[model samples]
Target: MPWGEFKDTVAERRIFQHRTLVALMLLFVMMGVLMARMYYLQVIQHDTYTTLSDKNRVQVQSVAPTRGLVYDRNNVLLAENRPVFNVTIVPERVADISQTLSELQAILNISEDDLDRFRGRLLEPRRPFQEIPLRYDLTEQEIASMAVHRHTLPGVEVNAELVRYYPYSELTSHALGYVGRINRDELQRIDPVNYAGTNYIGKSGIERFYEQALHGKVGYQHVETNARGRTLRVLERENPVPGEDIRLHLDIRLQKLAHDLLDGRRGAIVAIEPKTGGVLALASVPGFDANLFVTGIGVEAYRELNESLDKPLFNRALRGQYPPGSTIKPMLAIAALDSGSTNRERTVWDPGYFQLKPTGRRFRDWKRGGHGWVNLKDAVEQSCDIYFYDVGVRMGVDVMHDYLTRFGFGEETSLDISGALPGIVPSREWKRAHRNEPWYPGDSVNMSIGQGFNLATPLQLATGTAVLANRGVWNQPRLLSDVLGDHDFEEGLFGAARDDIILTDPDTWTFGIKAMEAVMHGTKGTARAAARKAPYRMAGKTGTAQVFSLAEGEEYDEEEVRIRLRDHALFIGFAPVEDPVIAVAVIVENGGSGSGTAAPVARAMFDAWLLGFPAPDEPVLVKSDPGAGE
Candidate 1:
């Protein structure tokens, strides 16, 4: 045997032993690394991993606030909240979203829009397992059916929600406005944290004006949930601060009366408590159902409302600007009487037409036959165009413009309601600024008659009449009688007087009232036909506002004109001339004959409101005044 061979054998054995030791060391190191990772994940980072796991199981839910209710001055509900059920979903809980949606479509006739909305919502960075709204305002049958088969559905859920409801339907549509689902624009406008759980917001009218008071604070519940993210129990809750309740100045009964008086005509009527500027009834006829807009309105329904020839969605009371027409005559006469530009005893003989002296453009009278010799009082009473034309031309546009502005024409009313239009009162400055034209005597005549660029809203007219009835105590019109909020705010913003509105000259109202009385009771009074035999004395002025430009030789033939192109019949009045209680302004669009059409409606409103005369079944024909028929 050789020694070298033995050594080689020993070397080979050593090499094999070293290789085995290295492999064992590497294996031990790998095991240690794996153990450390296991310990770290299972113990050290347990909360992070567990939260990630439970996120698949647990759910957080919101309980939306119950919207505040709206009431009329008499406590009649105008807008309210009604209970409704909705189908909801959580994306991560859904195993196969497409399959679940298909099943949901079968059970609930989900709209294509609903499915598209659901997909879009799921795409947002949201908690995957949190429930989201699928279908809103589900019927009882729908809820019951969905509940019955909900066990088979994984992520599908049913939630009880409160939806906005309008009880008056279309009666107070424009005044009360409407609420709808909050959108992206609203989201940016609204406080995200406060409106977190809110679904809808007020869009217009009083609703929008008082949105902050109506939209209650958000609430939260510390809810315990099951493995499927279903609510198991509620641990704690912070109750929501419900929104303030609002009591409007509207009288629902009177509102109904005024609405019915319109008889589905395209018109607007506003009645106010003369002393307080509290609107008893403000109605815009041919109004839409506000409830239809509470949720998301259908495109077709929206289009129909927006494109209707009658303009059902138009808020005529706040936004409609019409020429004051003959209604402006009483105010014009008041201006003349107050400014000493003309005396009530002063006489102007009407030969049925007025000529602008140097320019022989005749301003024709509504009466073909002459009103004979008429005093300033008689002129207002008869709405004699020729007599006003003469006095207005004498008073000039400057003096008349200054006086009418004091009565709120061509100005935005300080009413609490939003979106009041400040009508244009054209003056030399305004005409020059807007039209780049010089003022004319004919323009003054037109303005005196409330034509030729002059415009006024029904609210403005009512407020102005109220000021007259209140003897020039101009009260800022307020719709909310009481703000049911926690904090107390002053009656008016900017320290305005709420009561005892003082007029510089109270005697002016007396003179104006006397002239308006003549309009109802004096011989040749235009509105006498409607108010002559009233149980109570009503001092009113009838107005016929031309909607189209009539040629110099053209007589207005209502039948020849389109309904939308006809004159707007206007009337403004206060009842019991000596001690007025109610003031009103009525505008019937394209309704010819203010005395026959507009005055009668105003008479009915006065009877129902101030006189407490129950609504009459038919049009009661009172005896014509000796002054009737202009």
Candidate 2:
């Protein structure tokens, strides 16, 4: 009925036109929204989206820089870079990792250790497409096999790279140290951008101390990759900066001599040039091959090194703690003379033991019957323990500590090597802190004789001997002779002595030197018999450090004790005493007597350096010259 009422032709035509216009406007609005979205994606976010798309086919890779070279004082190559082939894989690009690994094992020898290391890396947080090394130093047969299966294996590749190598690895292991795979701890400490491509880092010694100078700048390249993430070609590259070449003060020839002299013996020898404070030789017996560490050392090989009885991994030169024994006699004699406690002419009557009071504990001397009527000179020459015991009580622990500290006893020598320990210089305060007890008169006597709470590293003994050689001039020992970079010798690139060990009366130093000289040449000198064949005059002191103390009523019998429990033989000396050149310290573990076991090693070292062995080849590495290339 309503439709019939509205059936006027003109009104109906107007209503139909208005509804059609409204529908057309709604369609146009939808088209405008769709066009706006298309424009935003095509123009505003163009670069961002393009980059994401290209990432599937392109990569930005890091190029490792060539590491610097290392040379001895004579320009002999100590550390070098050699080319090695490695088998690597990109995890993301591999289709079936388990199947691929199984196939790979069938073609080559992959030990459980190798597989374990690879699996460990897979679990680590690393870049998705980074090349993970599986086996280093791949053989020719392995390379050929990899080539035959190249097409089937999409992500596997054989990469060639330079690796760190040592020529005389065993000889330089302790001094030069060695490089090892960078662990997670080291990675977190290093700059990510700088160490993007680096895999190895210095593990110890010189290598660790100078890591900054040894690791060069990183570089980058834009690469075109395929579907399997294989590098098709390098599009653009920026070259990296090479590291600095280092020339050491160490004489490899002398290092070898020291090693040979201590053949199969557990001992340490540290020799220094007194004038320049350059370390000439640092030898620790039973050293491991440094090359074994460059690439990840095998599990068995590492186990052997870690479980060795002689402790080949231990750096005896830098960290060995032992009783200085009689080596401290000359130092104590100086303390006595300078402190007004005693003089070169002072004498003490010894009946084999010492007592601070009229009736007290008897401090037994090395001689059973005691050295009777011995003076300062005779005490040092004969290493009379009783004479030192008498004076040490009078000097007190405070005086002894002060004098020894000045000689670099309680501190590190700052020898430009890592892990050097500070030998203890015991005082009342130190005793209270460490031993949790008060200082006693007997403690003073023991300190005076370089025993009891006293401990000295081989490095410390060498440093103290250098002070005597320099005649009170405290030249800090250093291993870096020259940094083959912008450095000036006159400017003192290495370093100067911290300061001279100034004393009130400098003549006391001469008195000390004279006493040391008697120990090598005097008739009753402890080491005279050992030094009889020397062509040159040497000043030295012999000491036997007790590994285990004897009770007041007990006596030490060597045959009854274990070999490791015997005394540690020690000797400190300098050649050409009048004008000293080389100062050395030797320590033989479990050696019965210093004069017999340790002095011979020192004599042999002096003979090698002074009496002359074959010289290093021509063109000895001279500092301040920059043209020398690897």
Candidate 3:
């Protein structure tokens, strides 16, 4: 016990108290800093963090509106919506995507294409916990099978939604068209907010023409979801407004009749009501089932359709460009009379052929010994080529082009359907632009026969025929008759009356109609045989267009060539000549004679529309018009 160690106890105690006070002050400063940090996070930044946390559990979902229904004039459903089951997966909930996909493959029988498409979607930008579809349109058995294994799968879900369905798929595919899944390109172009939950988009025909009206507005809902992102309850909802219904002017019965008439041929038939220009029936043979394109068509099926020899996917009625041949005679006759190129009393001698320049080139008429001294009426009724050759040469290419353009040739026609192609009407500008050659006298002569560079679609021919039936009052051909949408849209949306084709002399219409009538009722008319058994008078014209060019001086012997290389047969007509009802244009590919093949088909349609369709009960009206062809 040293004296210094024992006596310094009070001083050591004071030093220890000083160290404890310093440590307490430092501790108090650290606690104060931590409290301030906590207050900043919990109070000032509270809303931001809470919103982030709630988004992980609660979700705002887009609700797709119901698509519109499409009906024919008789209320027959052409296109409708049907509930289809789709299997979707949420990537966030899927713990091991590979394992989950394998399990889904076993349960859903997913194809390799489905997996590829799913992976492609996964690469694209999307909302959190959004369902990505793996397969569409599941069968009842598949749905039941998925339900049995539902508990085993965490992120998988079976979603039900309405999809487009065309009941008369083959019959009305060209008229109604179809919808398909929206693509990346379409996504860039479409309204993101409006099409939020929408998947399918209209691809062609009427469906494409009225896509906006058919696809209704999008809706929204506040939903509470669990940790796995399953919707537990709907907190608030805004109901969607459904799409409007559309009614077409097509008559199913007449459409079927037209189809039956052109059953075996690879040609098109377009029939329109003379008054309103409402298309009664538009048929292109060898059509495909339009449903194959709705829900992501398989590569194999698409390839098959794309490679088919018959071209079932082609809309021949609107897109097919064929040589108009004698079908142009009626239009030319009107042109000849109205343009002051030729008079009705004019006549031309045909020694079985025509020449742009004598001893230059001989363009042989269809008959070896041609029509003798053909007049304008005889030229149209018999479809005499030599008479037109003289007139066409006299009028020249420019006048013919201008006159024919007025008749809707070489133009888009501006129809409601999206597939119409503006057929070629050979002009000096068109020839120089496309063929890089100048228009020649021989070109004019060939155009007279609709041979050289002249091209016209069946729709164009039908439209021209309808114009004739309407007597210069042009009504553009249309399929949509009524659109039952919001704000009385039916009148505004569909069946709009187009501009008329006003003629210089209205009496020229009577002249053309009288000549067309002679085509079926006259003694030596080309299509006179077709009018033989008919109970009603019809104005018609027969046409024969060469499929392959005949070599100089090579005769056209149809039986010698291959079936596909033979001439195309065609006819155009309207029934009950006094007050026309139906105007039709029929074309039969490689069927030899227009009178023998195409004329009969037009006669059948005329009978079905004028006589057979109206019941016998309306006897007075039916008997009022003269029966038994002249």
Q: Count the backbone clashes (under 3 Å) in each candidate.
A: 5, 2, 0
Tell me the whole-model lDDT of each prediction, alpha carbons only: 0.79, 0.84, 0.84
Per-residue lDDT tens digits for candidate 2, residues 512-570, read: 88888888998888888767867789999988888864568766566655677777878
Alpha-carbon runs more than 4 Å astray in model 1: 1-60, 90-99, 112-132, 485-505, 549-561, 613-630
Report clash pairs, candidate 2.
326-543, 352-370
> Which candidate wins on TM-score?
3
lDDT of prediction 1: 0.79
Candidate 3 per-residue lDDT, tens place, 336-396, comes to 8888999988789988888876677788887778889989998888778899899999889
Q: In terms of TM-score, how similar is model 1 to the real structure? A: 0.85
For candidate 1, write residues 1-630 as lDDT tens digits. 877765777788999999999999999999999999999999999999988775554534455677778999889899888887888887778899889888888888888767766676676544334567788888788888988998899777898878889999899998888888666667676777777777788899888877877887888876767766677777778888777788898999888888887888889999888777788887998899998877566666789899986899888998998888888787777778767788867888888888877468878888888789988777777788888887888888898888788878787765667888989788899999998999998998888788888989999899888887877777767787887658444444524453443434667678778888877776766777677568888888888888875578776657655666767888899998868888999988877778778888888887777667563565544221212232
Sort every candidate by lDDT, greatest first: 2, 3, 1
Residue 384 in candidate 2, Cα distance off native in Å: 1.2
User: What value does the lDDT take at residue 123 in candidate 2?
Assistant: 79
| Residue 18's lDDT in candidate 3 | 99
